[model samples]
Target: MMEPTAAVPADGSTARRIAPSRGPETARIARGTGKQWRLFNAALSHTPDFAYVFDLDGRFLYVNRALLELWRKPFAEAVGRDFFELGYPPELAARLQRQIAEVVATRGQVRDQTPFTDPDGTTRHYEYIFVPVLAEDGTVEAVAGSTRDITDRLRGEEELRTAAAALSRSNLELERFAAVASHDLQEPLRMVAGFLTLLEERCAGQLGADARSYIGRAMTGTTRMQALIANLLAYARLGEVGEAVAVDLGETFAAAIDNLTSRIAETRGTVTADALPTVRGDATRLLQLLQNLIGNALKFRAAMRPPVVHVSAERDGTGWVLAVRDNGIGIAPAHQERIFGAFQRAFTSGTYDGSGLGLAICKKIAESNGGWIRVASQEGTGTVFTVHLPALE
Candidate 1:
């Protein structure tokens, strides 16, 4: 044992006690042992996961601090104890013994998931691995393993499965309802519009100016209603196209322009289109999508500028991106998202006359045809509508 001491002045005028000296062997041994134990504690006892070693006979050899704390058993009581004596369920103890035996026989590793209950009665899931520890003679000495808690991971997977099932059912019901309602409403609307036309033709001469004006307003209302119903039906039938075929988008663009020829002439709009790509989708629906987007550019023209729309296509990883750039009054940032929703219009109907279903229908059609749509706009500058579609090989 070393004794405590007080130092004297270097002049040797005061009394002093000499300090005891331990030999170099003692100092070296202390330094080596300190470093070894510190590393061992960090790698095993202080680790987050549960680590343990047991013989092929199922006797516990060592358990790390994490496992000891979980079991609420001290090393003195846990060491050398059989798996069952350590409070593991008999079935679990036997299953673990089998896995350890297999690892020893194969001289390899085995991994598995096991459910465990802590001393506090909280059940947890563990993903564990067993590795064989071999003796000097290559015989099975023990099995070493670690287990990570995975209860949260299993719970998340179960929740995702449940949500996916619910969403699938909701989509099916919505499709059925939209199809039936649209089909049923078409006939009655047609009859109302036909009778209104007949009344205007038959009673025009006999009616006063006010009555004639009222009839004209009624005709306009019916016309707008008919357009709404048509858009609704088209939206419902979007993804219902049976199978996609190779479609030349150049032809599709031409067809869309032809459908809107009168409107283009009325607005004095000029459409310049680049060479378009051939894509895989229903040509009729693709034509409709283009028609709506081009018509929108024409209708929403700036008051001072003649609408100049440019149509172009380019390849975008595994798909084609077609852009319809318009020199029109661009959409406001605040109203951009709402305009794509059914019956949602950004501008007042008085300023921009529409049923507000054009963009919504375009979105649905794009999605149904294995594509999607997006708009980039600035309030007073201009707007560009981009559509992404899968290209034909």
Candidate 2:
């Protein structure tokens, strides 16, 4: 064993003794080949991280000031000791010894984390790495280790997880309430609609023009209310749908056009499409997404021309971008982002007959499938809605 030598402080402060282990090989390195020991001690002594060196036998050969402060011990007590002799718990000490042995045996690095309670009774999480210290001949002479306190980082991660769980529960409860309320309200709305129709038929000759007009307005209000409620329920229950799978975009596009065949014929609109790609998502939701976009294109057509809606697809990296372009009364830039929010519309119900949940539903469906939707338009020219979806893996 070499005698403990005083460390040269970089800041001209009081010196501390660093002991070298009992062995010709390790003692020679620890004695400092010229000024190497002094430089090493000075660089690591004041660092916040705990730095130390261990011999092949897992005995402490050197420990920096930070480590000594953590243990709340002097050089005399900790320098010549292993983890077990320093009063570390049996399990922790054994694990650390094994890591140190592995580093020496493999001549490589070992990384791990553990929780430790300091002498001051404050428990902290630590991430540490052990690496072999090789001699000039490429032989493993010792194992050098560094440790950092990661308690704050771990605490932050746990807090984020707790907040996310709380938010998820709240959303689930809200969705359930909306679905139940929507279902209950439908029967009453149907009854009101039915009664209005009967009143209009039976009292057609007796009622005056003003009285009939009031009844017509009432019926329209009830119809709009029913549509709003249905859309709200669909929005809330988006998460309750089945899991996603590979779906053929071509089939979904064809189905949407077929469903809108009557409306297409009534407006003399033209719907065309190029070959679409397969995507990873719920087929039902994808169909709904297409229907909503295409429906909006048809509903918001320019007064001077028949609706011209074209659907196309192109590759976007590992994903696919599906575009629905229409020659309709385009949206203003200010309303582009707002249109994706529930109950938001660029135009009033009188101008466009819609529940205002179509684009919002499209946005939700795209996001739920690890994709997104965006819009570009110049009011009075036309509008383009592009939906990015993941390619089937």
Candidate 3:
């Protein structure tokens, strides 16, 4: 048998290799091993991801074609060099060396992300993982690594963050404007209503029926305007409310019913409920939501019969679906979706006494609590408002 010898490259550089033996059997085995090595190299060389193997000393033992291209160095130059010798930044090289050492010491994987500038001056992000290669004895032999370019993914995420920040600022500005405008208008509206009432009282005997009617209409207009302004302020302040907490829907429902007790009696309306669930939400907002829905049911009753509103909850996966069903003048299909928008009303103010912010506020509360509210109705029958809220964990 002949001893294995080092193969010399074209540059006269000594390389680790096995010298050809005299026997044909040894030569056949060497050829088969070389063919397998070629096949393995070819497969790795074609992949877009950078693949490499590092010796225990943090020196590169092998680098795939993608890595060679990234480094802009030939195989001979990169294969024997470490990160520092290959011109990686000192800090980055040190970090990589430490991670490689960790993988070797723990016999586990280490993953990280980093930014690198190419020779062409284009900086890109990369995510890489280093894993230990184990020998038959369960000892760390070497560290193998793969790096993927994540620049596009990171760029997309940054863009989305920028858009979200812009939207948040815009919403804040709009809410502030609404609050200021509604607050400033209220005092003047009150003054106008007060003066109109005084003028009607003073001129009662002298004025004709038409004059009194005009004054009465003017007072009514101002009253409705005041209500609208108040509702606007409330809606604007929704964004300024405190964070959500665990709230018992049953308690909020009871409170809402208690608040509307007088109106319920006046309208001859009956409000009933089933067992309610505990939800993750603000108690005040949840109470307001119930008040709005139940109040609407009472207010929009058909003249032919007294109102009947039923509140119930059922399990929906890990959450609960709260339903407020009412036998009243149901909304038209065309107007159901529109009514959720700010100041949108399905019926005229003359027929329905409301500022039209009730459903809109309910919708906002639902969304802020990571839930949603929807309505189902036929024109003449009744309406069902369903709110889906997550259960408190």
Candidate 4:
């Protein structure tokens, strides 16, 4: 019985059997994998970032074209050579070697910012990382590294810092001027109002009707001016005094209502509030913020109905959002943004008696206490003023 005999080994040992070749589809997949590796290698060579590999002893194992061009050396000269021997500054070379050693020791990656000098002798900033490459036995065999030029980014950041410093100084000067001017101007305004009152009383019978009317208008103008100065001073002084503390908004609401007791009674305004959260801010400023909003609601009532204002607070992200919604002559869309500026009035003084600094003051107070204020309203509908403030722990 003939059985196909196995071939004898040339070295007198058993011969190993061969497996059949893979199908054409398998070959195609293998070709695709090789193509991907070639594409990756091409990308590494062409990318702007410098890519390289270093052995355990900090000897260059593989250096991409980008790194070679930065060094102004050929790849043959770079491989097997240490970074310090390739024209890099000693300090920088030492720092990078230390980082590589740390990566090898911890078998982890290290990332940092480094400065390097160009061929033109100008220092450039770079953000780079050193990643450990491990062998199959789980030991770190090499360190792969990449560096991105961050010189432009660093320059931009420096410019921003400089601009911020200048802006801060300008704000401080403006605040000081407002405080000093407001204080000095009050005395002269008081004298004018007092003397005008005396003149009107002394010459009451002798003065004609037109003269009396003129004097009355002068009195009104002085009163309005005084109010404007007071509000400007208040706005400038926000966050200039008093440390922030845990303040119960419920108490603030009560105090605001108390401040507007006379107006509320005159207008028969009904102001209701929901349970409010305690926030971190100056109690005095918070009370003022509430008073301004409530006062506006009472003053700008929809003539068709008695003023109804609703105050409520809710949790919003890392802060508390308090809203004062009022049934009043709402603000037009065009004037909503401008109303927040100091002395920027959308309505005439004859219609609404205000210094136009209330919302501006509220904005400053909110920002100083780490918060912000915004308004949402439509003409003839209603107005909602929202203040977001950080809640107490």
Kindly indicate the candidate among 1 and 4 with the higher TM-score. Answer: 4
Model 1 per-residue lDDT tens digits across residues 127-170: 99999888999987788889999999999999999997886667
Best by lDDT: 2
Highest TM-score against the true fold, candidate: 3
Task: Note the Cα lDDT for every prediction shown.
Answer: 0.81, 0.88, 0.86, 0.83
On the 0 to 100 scale, the lDDT of residue 266 in model 1 is: 94
Candidates sorted by TM-score, best first: 3, 2, 4, 1
Question: Distance (Å) between predicted and true CA of 352, model 1?
Answer: 4.3
Candidate 2 residue-wise lDDT, 1-393, digit = tens: 345443333332333443646677766565554356667788898899998888888888788888888888876677668999999999999999999999888999999999999988899999999999999999899899999999999999999999989878888998989988988998899899999999999989999999899999999989999999989989987875567899999999999999999999998999999999999998999999999999899999999999999999999998999999999999988888799998799998487777888899999999988899999998998999999999997
Task: Compute the lDDT of residue 66 as modeled in candidate 4.
Answer: 77
Question: Which 10-residue window in model 2 sums to the lowest lDDT?
Answer: 6-15
Judge candidate 4 at residue 385 and give its lDDT: 95
TM-score of each: 0.64, 0.83, 0.86, 0.79
Off by over 4 Å in 3: 1-47
- How high a TM-score does candidate 2 get? 0.83
Local accuracy of candidate 3 as per-residue lDDT tens digits, 232-345: 888987885556789998898889999999999999999999989898888888899999999999999899999999999999987899999999989998898799999899
User: What are the runs in model 1 whose C-alpha is more than 4 Å off?
Assistant: 1-37, 43-48, 53-62, 76-111, 117-122, 129-145, 180-187, 229-291, 302-306, 312-322, 332-338, 349-352, 361-374, 378-381, 386-393
Candidates' RMSD to native: 10.5, 4.7, 4.2, 9.1
Model 2 C-alpha lDDT versus the unseen true structure: 0.88
